[model samples]
Target: MPNSDNPSFQTEKASERLQRHADEISVRLTERGAVPNFPEPDDRTLRSFSLGEVAEILGVSGSYLRQLSIDGLGTTPETGTAGRRSYTLRQINELRAYLARTRRKEALKFCPRRREGEKLQIISVGGSASTTTSLYLAQGLALQGYRVLAIDLDPDGSLSKMFGYDYPGICFPDRYVSMYGALRYDDDRSSMSSVIRRTHFHGLDLVPGNCELEIFERESTKRFHSEDLRIADASIKMVSALKEVEANYDVVVIRCGGGIFLTAGAYGAATGVLRTVRPEWPEIMSMRISLSFLSHFVSLMEEAGMSVNHHFTKYLVTRHNPRDFSQQEAVAFLRKSLGHGLLTATVWESDAIRDAEVKKRSLYELVAGAVGRSAYEQAMETLNSTNAEVMDIIYEVWGRPPMYVMRASRIAGKASS
Candidate 1:
């Protein structure tokens, strides 16, 4: 069963009605004194569905069930001969719920008016400082033509500098228009429009960061101590800011800091979290620690009576060196361990990326002139391929086309209007 706090669990009609549907069928069969030809598995036996049985239950063919598993939509059944494969009742229920929602979506598509305020996905990218992986992914998405707003919440200002902001710290006065401004609680929420600044890269905007942003921790702590703020208030502030400008961008990527206070806030507001981990021993160890922290944070949020809408956490392998035996071994381990949770994208090691960082330019803007032609091309290919995979994951989760495609749809909608 899905967690009660999960938004999808709360609103998915098919999921909510599963038990009732079963009960109604059971009652009708009992009245008729019918001996059911097929076995009706108990709901408690969620992990006991054979492939053929579940297929019959969901009204989908066995081949379709296999395809869904292959496409990473549902759990992979234990493999056996063509007639012997088996699935879990939980997997079948989930698939049925998914199909129901998809059918509902298709029906809604032909309706007269689209729903107002379609969700603007806010993806929180969290990782250690060792790999500036979040920044690369953000730039890649922007270059791929998505309307992307990248908020730099790290007090180190690395993301700020990468976009050509030379300042080490945001000045005091500018705090009102920075991330601090957006998360600052007041009677009238500050407009994120004024705080967002255009970056040099096309389709990418920045919510500039600086060391001064660290003051958010102090302010949040003060509010919490005074009993005027809840544990979830920081996240509320973040979500509210994004909602205010929801129509302006297709996606919002927040770069979280090292501190739990900031990262927890970002997690609370995120639809999903992208975790970048390098395939090295030390980095893998850190990744474990980070995962544990995230788990604890979610538990605390639930305990504090906050409704968590977060659906998934994905892992991206960064700084991978194919030739290194240890890295190859670790990558293999991760693939087996994480299974579908691991992204198809892998950021291969490249010196050109380091060069771009030193020059304070986005990797998307790097050219053959700055680095050797061959090296630049190779780097671009690796980065673009990795980002493209990430984009596929985004599309799957958001169930929407890219911003450019959405623009045409919007225009056609208006012309009809």
Candidate 2:
């Protein structure tokens, strides 16, 4: 009998089609080394290069280099032989073209949905409880009129629900499209925009999370080769993808899931570095564990062949309660490395925050209401104070930014107001 089963037949057909495409891509890689062009990239065309090689070529820090090497920078590295990391030349070349495009600042006017020209910032959030921080920060990004894609890399999908996510809409997008699924199953989706999902906001798009992320962990653990494919790898993939979409958004905000302390095993980590060591006291373990996690995360990324670049990350501490030990410990650890954009307090923790959240808004959004207005006025004052201190740090570190300007901005603003 000829093929009669629709589901089975479709799956087989899809598999076959993907295999053929893979062969074609493989051949192309052989010819081009994944770069779009040999040495000359033109206005009408895009050139590609390998991710790691590009990092070497540019001499950027390691953390920034990892951004280039994404098929989807798995939160961990995809390990095969001991100490070996792998990447496809096609994906690598795609990333190379992306960086090249951005570096050249070439004028691209492709996507009709996109406005004429805007600078897109790729902001990825990583750490436990990054959702709240990302959302709060996203309000600021949205206010700036930059198109934003808030990606929920966690399996829990908290960010998706924060603004209300749709399962059927994404799962069965128009024609049951899983941009990632199609790539894995049929090799149709090459870039991140191919899977871009719209959110409630006009300027925001989402590539929401799914329970299948659990399977990615499970399969990786079993196969053991993809150990370094941490979720951040996905950040690299999406960044490269967005770059291909012609820099559609001004900022791409990624919400990293919980601490590596939770997913260390999945990443095939030493387990000791990823886990908290037990001291004489339970509190001691917790204390040391938090510190260890901070250092360990950077170390793990380095181990996976990604360099640590300070410009690539900013640490934010939330809740802001003076009494909480964990929060206190975290803040102390964070304060040592100041000037990297730390929001030491959550606005909701204060009355100003509750009122602001209830309004489905930001503290800045409430500048008109009496309480909202008062809070923001105070916030600006505080911001000015903080900026002065940061400026001092900069002056101390660099001996440049005249200290007078820092003190003067606050004093001048106060007198004018």
Candidate 3:
């Protein structure tokens, strides 16, 4: 061991040294061009959807959409090679709005935005794959014409990266504010609307997360130990914050982090809770512990006179490998154990999803065949099917028929006529 009197042995505190290392790493990454400099938020644009994709998403026939374009009804789509047409997300929304206005009978189908008496839906997604699940679910809802707000509660800022906020790389504390600014218990707390940032996804906004969120956890814990009952009330700070921008969105999807304080706030604000789990045995066991903790948290909230009720609570199995016997066995076991609480559709593990993430994009943001055709198709099928099932649940909670069922009824009526 070095002598204490030796000047060379003098060192900064561990925390200070670690922070310096992080700053050095970030600087090195920028210098090496390993990460792109932060682009303008408007510079990140979603790819246009082909005519078939728009038709499917809008639950309308291709012929009807083509005729509408010919008649100058909605925004004209961009004509591509060989006269193929594609619609930007903004154009798609314009078409949805036009159809909802002109065709009142199918307005709900055309524009699924919430109506009077419908409370804003807030879904909290937690567990190992929370970031991935939240990313797809929020973008999927936006694609289907629902106004969505995605709040990133993770200190790691993984979900923020997916939305083009690259945390330390692009989103620095001095510039962009995280959800912590809105949820902080001090007089400096800002309105939630002020912290909200627009994303490339037309109908989806983001409250990006950064290192500052970790401060909320530390402060809240200190308050709790000091016998501050206000901390209990602050557990619903997210709910209070969301109310300020409630009218702007139909749903809010929150990616829960590991911090108990923030996770509790997310749980308190949620109208629904989706717990994601991998199909491996170890992960399943870990999920059981998480569920037990959730139960205890709910009890505590209830004891404090806070209503802990949710519209729905569901488990989603992610990163599923159908070819693996062990994973198949795990899925079967989960289905048996969780019963109706488990979603029927599982998100398959696909190379396409991994590839997209490497580029800091979601599968939804990629054009068809951007990845290998077969891989992309399989990945999209898994995502669409999984999100569809969740949407059906949301519809059921609202006492409305499933979208597929409504579409089928309309088609049946046309055939009978």
Q: Per-prediction count of colliding residue pairs?
A: 0, 28, 0
lDDT (Cα, 0-100) at 8 in candidate 3: 38
Error of 3 at 199 (Å): 0.4
Comparing candidate 2 with candidate 3, which one achieves the higher TM-score?
A: 3
- The TM-score of predicted model 1 comes to 0.65
Best by lDDT: 3
- lDDT per residue, candidate 1, 1-417, as tens digits? 657886766667875577566667667775697633222222211134566555643434678877877787756667677646665433444555566566665432211111344466677887753226667777655434456788888787677767655345434332253577777665544578867877655557888776656777887788778966777777777878888887777677888887566788889889878888889888889889888988887777777887888656788887788999999999999999999888765777878777877876645554466767666766665565555555655665656443322432333354346
Residue-by-residue lDDT tens digits, candidate 3, 130-149: 89999999999999899999
Q: List candidate 3 stretches off by more than 4 Å.
A: 1-42, 169-176, 229-231, 404-417
lDDT of 1: 0.66
Deviating ranges (above 4 Å) for candidate 1: 1-118, 129-131, 186-189, 226-228, 400-417
Q: Model 3 misses residue 343 by how many Å?
A: 0.4
Ranking by TM-score: 3, 1, 2
lDDT by residue (1-417, candidate 2, tens digit) is 645665656557766866676767657775786632111211221122233433432334456656533444422333455534433323433444455456654212111122333234445554443565566555444432345666665666666555555342222212222223312212444345555666544466776665544544454444345555553443233334556754666555656555232233222211111111111234344544655776675566567665444322333443355566765665565566444445432322346655655544444433435365565555434433333332233233333334423443645475458
